[model samples]
Target: MTSHPVRPVADLFAADGRLKAIPRRPARREALLAHLAETLFEAGRTYREAEVNEALTSVHEDFPALRRYLVVGGFLARTKDGAAYRRQQRPTGTGGAIPAVA
Candidate 1:
């Protein structure tokens, strides 16, 4: 099977700044999630689940999936009770760069 090119994060969105689509490939999705985590959540601040949903919904209608992906992708962390959320300082093993999709 052939691999897909890694599109720039900007290309994932429409001219209006909303995400046009969520990527399916792991590397591409990681890049998008990292971008979203950085832009949407402030560092060193805790957020309510409703707040996270609001922020995510501003970008995409499917906030729940985005929320799930963010958590699963390690971009966002939530309390055991699921009432709170916070952006992780950084995703592990990224070396502060988005890995290329290959």
Candidate 2:
């Protein structure tokens, strides 16, 4: 349930479905990041740190940064112990852009 109605930035990706660059604009980046987040996870599914990283690896070799984007962009939530991650359930029209931290 995204306010965005669509990803809105398909041009940011390459033919292989990997991002060409991380957008500097939050709106564009967050939208694309949201799409990337979904590919790495399923709704209501919980993943281990390694599992999350493995999934993100499909998009970027810098999996850690991608993971951080998902977390910071409010697409995923992580435990303090850093063992698990979960896809967030956001309210429709909220745009899923709330940062998990600050």
Candidate 3:
């Protein structure tokens, strides 16, 4: 069996003794946007750009584009200070129909 070379743990440590240069996978923009949209939709409420930005800070450092996408997609309504989003309800055909008196 061939022996594998192993680097010393100290070699990976930074001056502060923390692991240095550990790589992490980046978040997918599409997936992050979808999740944000779904979260807002399910909540049945609209959040301001700032609020949305704060909420998505973990997944996306830049939220301006995401906010714009949501507004354009009709998933969220935006305003200067905040936003108000309501689910689109289907109209019931009860207009002009008189109710029968029991």
Q: How well does each candidate superpose onto the true structure, as a TM-score?
A: 0.83, 0.76, 0.41
Quote the positional error of residue 98 for candidate 1 in Å.
Answer: 20
For model 3, residues 1-102, the per-residue Cα lDDT tens digits are: 655454443454467644343223222333333445665445556444456666545444445655555555444554434444432221234342322211
Runs of candidate 3 with Cα error greater than 4 angstroms are 1-32, 80-102
- As a whole number from 0 to 100, the lDDT of residue 42 in candidate 3 is 52
Cα lDDT, model 3, residue 71? 50
Best by lDDT: 1
What would the per-residue lDDT of candidate 2 be over residues 16-101, giving only the tens digit for each residue?
98878877767787787778777668987778999999888877788888888787667888877778888886445656454332
Superposed on all Cα atoms, the candidates' RMSDs to the truth, in angstroms, are: 6.7, 5.4, 16.6
**What TM-score does candidate 1 reach?**
0.83
For all candidates in order, the CA lDDT equals 0.83, 0.76, 0.44
Shift of residue 75 alpha carbon in model 2, Å: 0.6
Which sequence of candidate numbers ranks them by TM-score, best first?
1, 2, 3
Candidate 1, 1-102: lDDT as tens digits: 898778789988998889888888888989999999999999878899999999999899999999998877668878877888888866477544422111
Report how far off residue 9 is in candidate 1 (Å).
0.2
